[model samples]
Target: MNIDHNDEAIVIVGSGAGGGTLAYELTKRGLPVVVIEAGGYLRNEDYVNDEWEAFNQMAWLDPRTTSGSWRIARDFPNLPAWIVKAVGGTTTHWSGATPRFKAHEFAARSTYGRVDGANLLDWPLTLAELEPYYDKAEIAMGSTHTHGRKPLPANNNYKVFANGAERVGYKHYSTGPYATNAEEYDGRPASIQDGFNFQGDKNKSKWSTLVREIPRAEATGLLDLRPDSQVVQITHDPTGRADAVLYLDKDGNLQRQAAKLVAVAANSIETPRLLLMSGSPMFPNGLANSSGQVGRNYMRHTTGSVYARFDQPVRMYRGETMAGVIADESRHDPDRGFAGGYYLETISLGPAFLASFAAPGAWGREFTEIMEAYSRTAGLWIVGEDMPQESNRVTLNTSVTDKNGLPVPNVHFDDHPNDTAMRDHGYRQAEVLYEAVGSTGSHRTPPYPATHNLGTSRMSARPEDGVVDKWGRTHDVPNLFISDGSVFTTGAAANPTLTIVALAIRQAEYIADELRVGGI
Candidate 1:
């Protein structure tokens, strides 16, 4: 019952939202899949309720360097991303907000017009084209407020958020469209409101790959889920098609897995790093770098945080970490002093994290005063569409070698003017919302380690424009694909999980049809 190293199987890298969902979908369709995860397999019960403890257990702690004008370089210099490395990937630690990309978001290039210092391109596919997959993804994830699924009850934080939005005359505020179940639909229980999910949801109430896709995939017996298998390179035949993957196992031994098809879903940084590392005579630069776009146009959504402290206790952390969202500003209005827009969603951080991220190296009366108002704080995250620039990218730091003696990936970024404008506008609007609710004071926190990493392997209508085609197939290497946020054309003003899952589902359907007709 073991999959041989020489099996003509579909090999997938990374087991996050995209890869895990694809594995389940393809396995159910009766195809063989080998999912190689670079971290250990931890079940729901293994999740730690404590914030710092859980962070140590799940966060991708690999050595990564950050070089950017962004505040993250000054705050979290070593940790560029706050993603999980475990079996379920970052889905085990996401906030579960499932907002769909707006129709205009797909055509950002044409809709927003040309902005200086931005490498904007319209996505090859539109919202209308992917709407059906989004529906299927929502149904599969049992997303609340969609397809008859019940919405989650508003917590104290949400009540405050909704009140503030109402006072500010803003619409489109809601408790869901979230992937977490509200009334138990897919064998997982409803959210118990324990509020430890951002740490790691131990209750199994939240939907994650550990609680859903990975298990369903295992049940089909067509899955070979290998944890602690860090891929070093992808091997290709003289014909320039991917044929094998070279990885280092947990025991520090190198192993090669033969494949008929290879899907790279190792997030944005690692996915492109692997592609760049897998250089050969056929591809002097990298496997999919013929367009010179393998590691370019890298983007992390424009982000900031605002916390308002009122006179009375709101106990924001008593429920979900992120419970509600306000979509009023998630639009493109040139008069607003920005090219694109953002969303304001309720966010709660445990005291330890707040102290660390709210102000990285601050101490004194000002810092102490902020921490003292934890019980009275109502916080919101501003996630906006950031312009993608060709210079904002991930590159191999040949100067730094990893544990396996391979050059480590260095993430380099510089915030575009559009990003700064968007963030400033979002922050100003947030202050108005809080002031509308009679808040005594508000604190604005700079960007933290990125969670919504996108691009680096984007889709394009032409081969010279990007790394992948609309179907996520590599332009230079036909049998190779990207199945994560790496394939995002432009980062829309929404959480990328739902879309990543939707695209993975769509890719699965295409791969299935192609396998049937020998197109691959």
Candidate 2:
């Protein structure tokens, strides 16, 4: 498994929260690393003031180019799934709602009993075990919200919801920690509360993983970042260990990069796709697919939106996409007749183009009236937990191919009955809050596609049920690891960026320890 240069380096596939954090941790410990990102580098100045343009620049927009994109399915017709392919990945456009999964979330199956047709399992690690890493990730990302800190300022939106939740006897409080700058902890500039809107000039800042960790990794002189390199496959040796990677350069020229340890941080979809594509006699099903679980257990938090037209302007466009969150209904309580949890948050309604799509009205004069009334309206996003089902999986589509001639991932997924029930509970609760806020009109938005996809390459204690072990090491391939949301065993009812960063940090320590002991 020797290469021309015979260089030994840790190769990471993506530069999102997981990959970037891993690179930072490993390089800080004086380990050499190579990070490959499919998108080019972008700065804060590149972010514009138009929501549509900002979304396009921050995410994968085109349908054709993203035909084989992760979670963008042809099977589910009206669902809108958003994914990013840039250097910083989807973190560039993330709403920055950083909430830690509850302690019970790790043991949902054991606590709430078995979910039919679902693979609900407790996490190998507990929340207490990962709390330190969460704190580190939050500090590193300059998270602004005061969740585990002192009393936070209650915005008008938060007060309205909290008051309503208390009146209804729901145990609601503000625990939604955001990954934005609260104060100048790092060398970066302090957060300006005035510029909280997604497309406002004041919202500009360098807060992404690329902006934080990649620069530090580069300064270490042990990490090499190669943007615009699309990884095609992982090349393995006769012993079934990943030795190198085949990728297409920016100019579309095929090239190879050798490494001793390969970290597949290519998100949930692309990671499995890459592994399945790297087929050989030793791994005919796919690399590390002996258990046939490389792309199983796919899960995403089912999201619902509650729109309300208040008598007075709620000033929806004044702050970040996610400025406040409600956690009263976000804990799993089996006595509630549902097997999942949900969280509520106040989000911005972008300008005309984006707002029309999110809050669309029927055609004719009604549509015009709804559009005119949007100036006095605001809404809340209800994100509910979806149980991990083995039937909801991501397998290769032999019949479908991408522009690069690679087989696209076939995503077969549907909501569980419990998930729908949880959503209904959230919707009803949201209606109560909206009515309490003196809303003239209120309606629940239809179920749309979720961006927080997880559990394609889950982590378990044994290889019989997961692609990676508790430490995220591949079962079949030693020296190969996975560090991303794909490794989640259960999908918690919260945003996953902070959790992914914590896992990456923990994985880096494990890899570092193994390297020190000459153990793969």
Top candidate by TM-score:
1
Task: Tell me the RMSD of model 1 versus the true structure.
Answer: 1.5
Cα lDDT of all candidates, in order?
0.91, 0.75
Q: Write the per-residue lDDT of candidate 1 for residues 1-520, one digit (tens) a residue.
A: 1225665789999999999999999999999999999999988888778889899999999898889898888888889999999999999999999999999999999999998999999999999999999999999888888898899999999998899899989988999888887887779888899987887888777888878999999999999999999988899988988998988899988888999999999999999999999988889898899999998888999999999889999999998999999998998898988887799999999899889877788899888888999999999999989999999999999998888888888998899988998899888888898888888898999998999999999999999999999999999998999999999989989999999999999999999999999999
- Residue 30 CA displacement from its true place in model 1, Å: 0.7
Off by over 4 Å in 2: 1-6, 61-80, 145-156, 194-206, 353-356, 359-362
Q: Where does the lowest 10-residue lDDT sum fall in candidate 2?
A: 62-71
lDDT of 1 at 346: 93
CA shift of 257, model 2, Å: 0.4
| RMSD, one per candidate, in order | 1.5, 3.2
Candidate 1 clashes between residue pairs 3 or more apart in a chain or in different chains: none
